[model samples]
Target chain A: MTEERRPFVSARTVAERAGVSRSAVSRTFTDGASVSEETRRKVLEAAGELGYHVNHLARGLRERSNIVCLVVADMTTPIRARLIDVLTRKLQAAGKVTMVINTGTDEQSVASAMRQTLNYRADATVFLSGTPSAKLIETSLANGQQVVLINRDDPLTGCHNLGVDNEMAGREAFFLLRRAGCTRLALVTSTAHTASLIERERVFVAVAEAAGLPVAVMAAGPTTYASGYESARRLFGRSDGPDGVFCVTDLLALGFMDAARHEFGLTLPDQLCLVGFDDIEEGAWESYKLTTFAQPFAEMGDHVVDLLAAPVPVIPGRRIFQPVPIWRKSIRASAL
Target chain B: MTEERRPFVSARTVAERAGVSRSAVSRTFTDGASVSEETRRKVLEAAGELGYHVNHLARGLRERSNIVCLVVADMTTPIRARLIDVLTRKLQAAGKVTMVINTGTDEQSVASAMRQTLNYRADATVFLSGTPSAKLIETSLANGQQVVLINRDDPLTGCHNLGVDNEMAGREAFFLLRRAGCTRLALVTSTAHTASLIERERVFVAVAEAAGLPVAVMAAGPTTYASGYESARRLFGRSDGPDGVFCVTDLLALGFMDAARHEFGLTLPDQLCLVGFDDIEEGAWESYKLTTFAQPFAEMGDHVVDLLAAPVPVIPGRRIFQPVPIWRKSIRASAL
Candidate 1:
């Protein structure tokens, strides 16, 4: 059918044209509204002719938009920022509104942000930080709000947890390194007592010990480049530097690899073998080619928006995530 | 003066305590409200006692919250993500609400997102893209909104641009490399169109050509690691790999370095010397330790927010930007 184009118009004008009240017109555009589908088509067609671009913020005030609060912990990691970017695009398309709260590591600041997040009456809260405070989680649960954790393990019991299985990830690294004929190995993990790292560490150590291989553990202190630098000093100072190093996170691995190669001229799988978790975009770079546990961020992102859209009861619980390992040239086939 | 610690209270309670209407309490919290100082202080005290967090998004709905639309091109880089994170925190603290609009490489997406960005009745628009369209920039100016481009080039015309000088960065890298004594060199940069990369490429090529030294240009398409991977392959394919290679971005450098060392088994300085721009955290990783340009993301973040928070003018068009360089150990030392 041929359709005629009309001048751009706002929703107010569309409501006027449809002869329906503005609220009725709004209800037509709203998802999950009781408005008959027939009316929705009419409002949409009118909006099409009028060139109306819905003001989402206005919709929230009209109680027509469901707000999703995105709580991001740190921004230094490209993965964190990329996740936020991806979620923003998906949420915008799904017709849901987003409120971003960039919380600090400070407890008081986090607590304050949580309070502000509540005032926004977000339909759901997606916590991107590992180790989201127990106090904050309790408050969120008490308010009967749904909480979803990304790249975070759930210690809050009931919150929906979505992340790669760290235990399996650790084992994958250990087995891969062992097969690569590495005589000595080092585990590079940081000192943030979150489920994500803790589980990975526990599994890595357990598997390495069970195999009866001489393994050393290096606590990177915090997941930062400085920590990796320090770890390198310690590893290099050792009687015999590690032939293989499995970093718990990609950031630390990149750090370890850079310091080892650039500072000390160590080569991977020949002089040393390096592996990391989180197949961040940088890992595939011509320089790093970091062998890592590749979690499907896009898929996880899709799952997150869907999980949070519908409120779920938080039952204090545990969910161990499992992600496949992405193999690169960090280890040589001959060594394996 | 003793302050009473009251339990968390809603706005309604603050209204009751202040002996004013709910709307009055709202107006008091909102910026530029016509409330008396005494009344404003009274409302704030009550709200504080009750542990009330302002629902800025809600206030935004009522056209009370000064909406600041942040148009981010993308946040895939650690430095970019860090800057956006800092901007979000500062803006939130200042009571200026933030609404993000992502404008990636898609020109249509950027233009459409810009229109949606304007529908929010934003008091100002923060263009955070590397290449914000002239049309979008023009539209924002036409709408009489303050525009600030953080970590992006100053627009050719209209809007304030804040970014580091990547050209001087190139000059610095050359000097640093020359001091280290490598005659033949390779300069790898991301897309030649981005203002930052363009500056670096121009200065790098011009300076080397002027100095009568052989210089090869490696154009990495984007700022991601994958792009660097392809560039590194082509660079190494040369009859004799250059003694030193300079990547326009730390991320690209990391990738190029990874492919050279990990995949190709190239030894540092002997086979390939790597230096990159933007001393992102990953550049310091154990594997990369990229000697490169560095910008203070947190400082730039604070700087941009402060600019955005200042009184916006009814008149449009402003230019503001600053740059700094960070040096590391990715390049080779003077050949003895």
Candidate 2:
């Protein structure tokens, strides 16, 4: 549908003017294809005179448009920045030119992003770490463009969803802290809630209650370094502060660790235990040595590309990946 | 030249079919222009029937192109990531769609990026950090595109250059550490050198030598957290370890601080005083409270836009910003 609309100059016109066969013109343009210099020169001269420009989109007109749109909201976040770089490299290696759109997670911004995608006539769109409005997804599906949502669990029909198992990760974190001999457990999160963070917190609380362990919850202003630091002070201000804490994100966990050590002078693992999710690169720094659940970035990139290459009319499908626990020095060594 | 090559639909054709003046057709497309509803309806109908797609470039063929190309080499660096985000927002607000080209500092990649800028017929191009090859800059200048380089000091003729005053920043950092009663000093930097880091290091060495204070320099790998941690250990391995240290970047400083405290059991400010460049957010955490220099991101973004909007044949200009020192708990509190 997108390709047929472009104005193109047929190769036949160049061949006729150059006084050569159509196959000869193709040979001239094809790399490593044998074509006499004289014939190639004539074809090139004629094509240039006729203003014949190559339409890369026309070659894949029947099956694909060779263009992918990457939609992301926050590029400053460490994980999102890493994902964008990796995904862009992978898509470029696959011979697809990526068109990135930075949009807020609001309904109006998502609608605008969808309009931009339609204007570019993209063959596929990847929503990275934000819930795009359902209407936009349906509209994209209706236009024959595949839509893949990352780190989201939307049940929209005809869309592909991929995310880490946040519930299972939360349960594992609780058990690990408990086994490490932490009696008082707490959870820290930000106000600008993402679905994945919400799920991680909800499941963690549920598991602690099921085990009959008391829990405390603290809400930070935003998932930023400053917010986490301030929230940690508030948590430690209590007379009976929790000994074990799980932060919904690594940025928050880093803040909590710093405050616990520098401000409160608490000994880690011996006096307190910490766990974080989305194991960013900074988490492994010798200072933090944060124990976190590592999300599979390489696998996610491959899955997105594979889904796009699949035949159209893809039914709504869900693929969940188990998060791997990366134990470092943040938690005490424990045997199950 | 690019506009002449594109297939365009003239307003004359729409005017003739709608039986209206060509000026009326122009007024219909112009925003907030007073055109009768009946005439607008007729003009739009004629345009739709004739398949007339509005060419924004054609409208400004004599002056500017609505496209701006942003060429960056490193996307993972926190400061660069923040700059890209802020620049994109500012460009979008000014009604220009940015075309981002991620390239390496190598000659081949830089040349390829220049070709892409020419293909898009961008009005201007902004180089974030890496030094663009001289040939590419000259070629872009010849093609009538304005070129701006950030964090660079190359005397490239007819190219605008903007950077922070690294010499002054380095000198100030040296004095601040000295006032904290530090007798021995050291500087930590990465192997993958940038011009800004080089300038900072050069100035610090010059100042210390003039003050008759010996300085030690340690090089790290890639300026990552791990590299900083390793470099700190190497600095401590010697019996003559320095009491004060300055890292060329904030990321490295964070790592060094963490290692000094967590691994070496050294108390900050009492055992060692630290300063960093590019005051990143993580530096302000309660654990680090690093004293560092802050780059002016918002001002730089505005300056780039202003330079691009300047009249062509713009005489090359140089703009330098002063780096502000943000003091925190990383150093001893001073009345001054």
Q: Rate the local accuracy (lDDT) of all candidates.
A: 0.71, 0.78
Q: Model 2 misses residue A145 by how many Å?
A: 3.6
Candidate 1 docking DockQ: 0.28
Alpha-carbon lDDT of model 1: 0.71
Who wins the DockQ comparison?
1
Most accurate candidate by TM-score: 2
lDDT of candidate 1 over B1-336, digit per residue (tens): 112212224578888987777877888866797888888888888876655666555665544346677777666667667667778888888866566766665677777767766666576777667455776665555545567765556455766666676667778777777777778888887764676677877898788878877788877587777778778788788787777777888778877876787667887765666778767776765555567666766676676666666654422344333345555556656621
Native contacts retained by model 1, as a fraction?
0.44
* Candidate 1 positional error at A315, Å: 9.5
Residue B12 CA displacement from its true place in model 1, Å: 4.7
